[model samples]
Target: MYTYSDFDRAFINARNAQFRAQVERRIDGSLTEDEFRPLRLMNGLYLQLHAYMLRVAIPYGTLSSDQMRGLAFIAEKFDKGYGHFTTRQNIQYNWPKLKDVPDILDELAKVQLHAIQTSGNTIRNVTADHFAGASADELEDPRPYAELIRQWSTDHPEFQFLGRKFKIAVSGSPTDRAVTKAHDIGLRMVKNDAGDVGFEVIVGGGLGRTPMEGKVIREFLPKGDLLPYLESVVAVYNLLGRRDNKYKARIKITVHENGLDKYRELVEAEFPHRRAAFNGIDQELLDQIRPQFKSPYFTTAPKAEFEKAYAKDPVFRSFVDTNTATHRNDDYAIVTISIKKHGATPGDATAEQMRVMADLAEEFGHNELRISHEQNVVLPHVHKAHLPAIFARLQQADLATANVGLASDIIACPGMDYCALATARSIPVAQELAERFDALKLEHEVGELKIKISGCINACGHHHVGHIGILGLDRAGVENYQVTLGGDGSENFAIGERAGPGFSYAEIVPAIERVIKAYLEEREDDAETFIETYRRVGMAPFKAALYPDADKGRKHAA
Candidate 1:
């Protein structure tokens, strides 16, 4: 994990002090709610439906044990007893009191964390693959570049306020776990024909009312040119993107209005200026950032104990099969601890659980913890020999659910529960779905399904790319849930297709069950996942299942 330098600490303290005064003025009636909105938003504070929410950025989803402990302390002392880990790999304190926010910021500053650029129209937290340095499949760790981008973008004078909020994600692996296609700027590291690794830069991808996969603006961008090229892209968008209408303000919409060729031309034209302005400072910063992300000292260990535990305990076996991913070191395994136990909120972690995770990371995970975009905590460098002990510790903490890629492991946003903009509830729907699937005991059978839920069309929950996407809306004063099928968020990214009419809240679970049952019956074999079946058979079967009486009504009318 990257530690803050003296310069970084000084900057954060100064920012915190400024915000503290701003918060005080708001409380003292010098700044009214309307007057203080933008100021608070700039610091990642939001006035939610009921109370204030503070979103703390976790850059590239990396954290140390001390940082994790700090978050746990914040959850315990300041806000409610829990914090929600978001799809962007940030943590949100939903019930934070406005008066206590400055104190919380101070506390976060002590741990070298902040809420800077977590909101507003400027670039948000620069995210990367959660398994960046640990994953065996990646070309190189993406976090150094991510950190470089973060340092460059934080409070950048030109980009402090854009037409709309922008998100950027980087993934070094061939497999795209970072949802690169659904970001404003998505960088996937790829090897050129010359066998040199660079970036496949995808721009204009976004999900909301209007969802579109990013277009490949550059097939291979030289690693050295990354910062300037990114600046050029953002500069072009800032100048040309719509400011008249907030709906069409995003870069994605800008790209849509203007052809990709024209946008690319503009970006290319701006690139030389940006390149000259940078003058190699970005590369120097990157060189400094690289050492901070070097691989931890790995130990050669016998896997006999891990094998014994797997063989002897079915529960442990299930956990190992589901929760662990292959690490670069053969002796190490990347362990994803499921915070989504049956009936729990998808991403809410209690203070105690946070502490437990921190302890585990400190003890067994090389003092590093990663927050996955899927809203789970990962011990990215856990040795296989420690599996049994780690599993035992997790079991004690009630954090040992073995459903990493299963149906129950859902991704849901804090919808109507906390968000003022939400039209309906997301957490309840997610809870119901997880509980229902767990009770049925069919998740393992269902296998590798992603069910994302959002309260509205903003797609904060990434419903557009879920295998079974659920969008909850208020339909003429009633809660109606819409479903989309065959969506994928991987390297072969595609937006899901809608499956006809929305279902009532009461009708949703059964409707989803029908879809699952239909899949089980129609799939060619057990090995064929829901997505594969959907792709092969199309929406006809799932549609038939969701709206069983549609054909009956049609026939009767005829």
Candidate 2:
């Protein structure tokens, strides 16, 4: 909830004017596509299959109602009527025209939003736990540190161009909902033996062509040493990371090539000089910014009405049970407004829906919003007393899906439909799977299952961490799908194991159905979800279920 300082406002305004000029130059044929590519990418514009896509940063996934309304206005006035929320907690307009993007940035800057560093080989948007301050079990709010890092990283001259793009995520809760382990830099706030708060710094974790969990570079780093240590890590990576091969340019590759100990030693060697260079300016800024995150006023609203509604309304109960999370205050709850309606695109939210969320944030929530990496909009601080009415309002807007963390709550990237890198379709596969699970009425029965689908190996859909991951590929110029099992994205982070041969897009849905049926029949009890069952009895059973004809082929060979 930090408003822009005068310097911040001036800086963004100046950048926007420069970009507008660059856009004009490109449009006038003074610059070719090759020349304008880097220029547009720096401003978070991409040429997709049919049109230009604009990705706007939602720093740490935090937004005010006014900011949310700005996004709504952009969706309404500029591109299509809806926008796609991405895994990086950013929003993308898929059908934006190249000519209109600069205007969109101008509008965004009016609300303290921008598209800078959303693309390109620079430090990308800083992300944190959606429930950073409000989570009931969090050690401390991690957004202050995240904000500090954002201010330091954005437009830092030294890191403007690196071997590869870098991402940083912070998690305040023990549950690790932010998928910190899958980031270039992951910071988890923890209390030490003496109860002093600090960070557990992790480095070299990402999911792409090569998937690896981040390794702990430092067991405990005092809060004061955060920026200096981070600088050292990035500096080492910048020096040692590969640039010859674009595929291996990520810091994860750098960490993999150099052993963790060696990397730590290099970082330690540079830490002293970097630490001294800090000069406490970042800390001074952090001290000034921390006050902006004060908790909203809480009223002792009676919960009797919520209890009665939970008892009386099954639909409302279903929504509250599925979408609500425990809050720091007993009377407040964190509500996840799922954008994945059954059989719809996973992350697309209409302008009307965005406006509705803004209205709810203003009236019921603390006038703040968070976009979850799972592509859901979160009202992080809503009073329990307002649950029924909010649910009713959301229902009226077609925003009450009541399917958070369920089979129907799928995470998918825009595959062949929009992305040029995609080989197969992700949205259709996600749609089919979600619809199949809904038709079976087995999503809630399955219990706490995550299904992530990616169009390609880039892993934008986080298919690597899903309980049931479906990856689309182009095999022999045909669209084939691959499945992975037992992947997890929480505290127990693990890359999924592949099952077997790729299935046709048409066959993938039924294959997934077989896998689910196997889980339902083979699980010890309803207490065990798909992941638990897969862990207990490896991938053999699921593989067998997926390829039932394998037994006949073996029999014929015998």
Candidate 3:
């Protein structure tokens, strides 16, 4: 974790003090709703349906144990008793009083955390693969570069306000856990033929009304040129991206209308100027930042006990299989503490649960934790021999759900429940789906499926890339869900295709059940995942399952 420098601490302290004054002024009637809207948004405060929501930034999803405890305290004292972890690896407190926001921010700053640049049409939180430094397949640790980008983009004078909000994700491994293809800027760390480390830069990818996978703008950019190249790209988008229509204001839209070649040409044209402008200052800073992310001194633990537990306890084995990933260290594993427990809200964590995670991190997890994009907490460097102890703690705290990539491990946005832009309820649908699958004992059987739900087309839930995607829509005063098949968010990224007409809230879960049942029957083997089966057989069988009556009627009509 990067410790705050004197300059970093000073800037944040001053900024929070300024926001505190602004909050007081707003509460005292010196600013109207219109006057306060942008100011509040800039400070990461949103006036949603019920109350003001505070979105705190967790850069690259990395957190120290102390920071985790700070979040727990904030959840307990400042706002609601729980906080919502978002797909962007940020945390949101949904019921904070407007007057209490400044106090909340002050507390966050105490632990080197703040909510700056979390909203208001600037570069949002720079995210990376949660397993960045720990994964076995990584070419390089991506978080150092992510931290470099964070420092450079913070209050960037040129990009303070763009055509619209922008997102960037960095991945260190060949497998794209960061959903790199679904970001405005995706940086995949790679090595060229010369074995020199650089990035495979992808631009124009995003998921909203017009979902798009990014185009590869640069195959391999030398590490020295990364900041400058990124500058050129964003600078080009800032110049030519649409401002007339908010809906068409994204960089994806810019790339969409002008074509990939033209966009690439424009970016390429600006690189020389950008390189001259950067002039190695950013590289010097990156060198300084790299040492801060050195790995912890790992100690080997005996695996005999782990093997004994694995062989004896089916429950522990299931948890290990579902929630753990391969680590660079043979003795260690990357453990995902599932926040999606059965029928509960996907990312909601009570303050007590937060403290439990914090204590566990400090005690056994190298004093480090990561917030995964899938609304779960990660113990990235847990020793295999310590798995049973960690599992016991998680079980005691209701955190041991053991469904990481299964159907029940669904990702859902705060829908109409908390977000003002939502057209229908999303939480209920996700809960019902998970509960129904768990009751049938079908989730474990139907393994490794990504089911994402978004309340509206803004695609906050990442529904555009789910294996089984569900989008909630408002149809004639009813809550209707439209399903999409064959979508994925990994390296093989693809947007889902709509199966058929929208299903009502009551009918959606059962419809999903039918689709999964069809997948089981239609798959070539049990090992073939839903996305694989969908791609192999096409959408006819799944569509037939979802709309047996509609398909029968259509066949008769034809």
> 2 or 3: which has the higher lDDT?
3
RMSD of each: 0.8, 0.9, 0.9
Per-residue lDDT over 1-558 for candidate 2, one digit per residue giving the tens place of the 0 to 100 score: 788999999999999999999999999999999999999999899999999999999999999999999999999999779999999999999988778878899999999999999999999999999988999999988888888999999899889999999999999888898998999999998888998989999999999889999999998999999999999999999999999999999999999999999999999999999988988887898998899887888878889999999999999999999999999998899999999988999999999999999999999998999999999999999999999999999999999998999988999999999998998899999988888888899888887889999999999999999999999999989999999998998989999998888999889999989988999989998898788888889988888899999967988999
Name every residue pair that clashes in candidate 3.
none
For model 2, the stretches where C-alpha displacement exceeds 4 angstroms are 555-558
Q: What is the lDDT of residue 365 in candidate 1?
A: 92
Indicate whether candidate 1 or candidate 2 has the larger lDDT. 1
Model 3 segments beyond 4 Å from truth?
555-558
Which residue runs of candidate 1 sit more than 4 Å off their true CA positions?
Answer: none
Instruction: Residues 1-558, candidate 3: write the lDDT tens digits.
Output: 899999999999999999999988999999998999999888889999999899999999999999999999999998768999999999999999988899999999999999998998899999999998999999999999999999989999999899999999999999999999999999998889999888999999999999999999999999889888998999999999999999999999999999999999988999999999888899899989999999999998788989999999999999999999999999999999999988999999999999999999998899999999999999999999999999999999999998999998899999999999999999999999999998999988888899999999999999999999999999999999999999999999999999889999999999999999999999998899999999999999999999999978989999
Measured against the true structure, the TM-scores of the candidates, in listed sequence, are 0.99, 0.99, 0.99
Report lDDT per candidate: 0.94, 0.93, 0.94
Error of 1 at 117 (Å): 0.7
At residue 171, candidate 1 shows an lDDT of 99
